[model samples]
Target: MRFVSWNVNGIRACVKKGFLDYFHKVDADIFCIQESKLQEGQIQLELEGYEQYWNYAERKGYSGTAIFTKIKPLSVSYGVGDLDTEAEGRIITLEFESFYFITMYTPNSKRDLARLDERLEWEDAIRTYLLQLEQVKPVILCGDLNVAHQEIDLKNPKSNRGNSGFTVEEREKMTKLLDAGFVDSFRYKYPEKTDAFTWWSYMSKVRERNIGWRIDYFIVSSSLADKIGDAQIHSEVLGSDHCPILLELEQ
Candidate 1:
């Protein structure tokens, strides 16, 4: 089975930049996107043979997520538990026979760290939610998690430290989540690889120079670790500032 995740920035904007072309070429069994920044009825994607699911933010053109899967799931859900955080449409969960698939767009802590506290609360809530789902079956979680868990996950560790996405609190939350039983598929395969990143800054020459952060991820239950076939970063593909990442697992 193949799972792909990418933060499209904005689905509408990305479409014009060959999103569909790459989407068709990859042909992932399950394709998930974050930061869709869309509302209901805003766009329609003709994805034949794939069941589309979306969680649109209440506010127009804000945070959102979606999944397009070739296989039908037994059940589906939006949000994490009874949390009131769904207002931003950040999460979507799908229950298959053997796994619970979830995609999320983690809240960003603004440059001034305005949303740091709220982001931390979300971390705790989602961690608890993931654990609950893990009890039933292994979970496959993917999206723009919005944090670089370690120094090696970004381009300039020293300079980027304490920044919105690299703050100690944010990074620790990610560590705690992984300690709870998830495995970052890419790092699992390439433990020491450097300069590989997912999201790059939109500033001048940032993307061109490859100054980016590996904020997006494909995290699976630790139990599924051995089933992982390969984890890939399609840094060459572009539409948004973020590129797509893929994980292959033995079915």
Candidate 2:
């Protein structure tokens, strides 16, 4: 089974930039996207053989997430809990026979760190939610988690330290999540590989220089670790500032 995750930045804008072409070429069993930035009835995607699921933010043209999967889920859910239902379209959970699949667009701490407290609160809530799901079955979680968990995850780590996504609190939350029986698939495969990134700044020459952060992820319950066949970063694919990351599992 293959799972793909990408933060399209904005699905509408990404479509014009060959999103469909790449989407067709990849042909993932399950494709998850974050930061869709659109509301219901805004755009329709004709994805053959895929069951589409979307969660839209109450505020228009803001945070959102969607999942397209060839396999229909046994059940589906919208949010973590009451606190996040109407805030931003951040999470979608699908329960399959074997596992629970989740795609999340984690709240970002603003450039000025103004939303840090809220972001931390969200991390705590989400961690708790994920643990609950794990109690039932293994979980497959993906999307723009919005934090670089370590110095090696981004370029110029010293300079980026304490920034919104690289703050100690945010990184610690990610560590806690992993400690709670989840494994980051990419790092699990290539423990010391450097410069592998998922999201890049749109600023001039930033992407060109590969000054990016590995914020997006494919995290699976630790029990599934040996089933992981491969993990990849498609840095060459273009559309959003973020590129797609892939995880393949053995049947």
lDDT of each: 0.94, 0.94
Across 1-251, the per-residue lDDT of candidate 2 in tens digits comes to: 99999999999999999999999999999999999999999999999999999999989999999999999999999997766555688899999999999999988899999999999998888889989999999999999999999889999899988999999999999999999899999999999999999988889999999999999999999999999999999999999999999999997
lDDT of candidate 1 over 1-251, digit per residue (tens): 99999999999999999999999999999999998998999999999999999999998999899999999999999987778757999999999999999999999999999999999998999999999899999999999999999999999999988999999999999999999999999999999999999989889999999999999999999999999999999999989999999999998
Model 1 scores a TM of: 0.98
Candidate 1 regions exceeding 4 Å error are none
lDDT of 1 at 175: 96
Q: By lDDT, who's the top model here?
A: 1
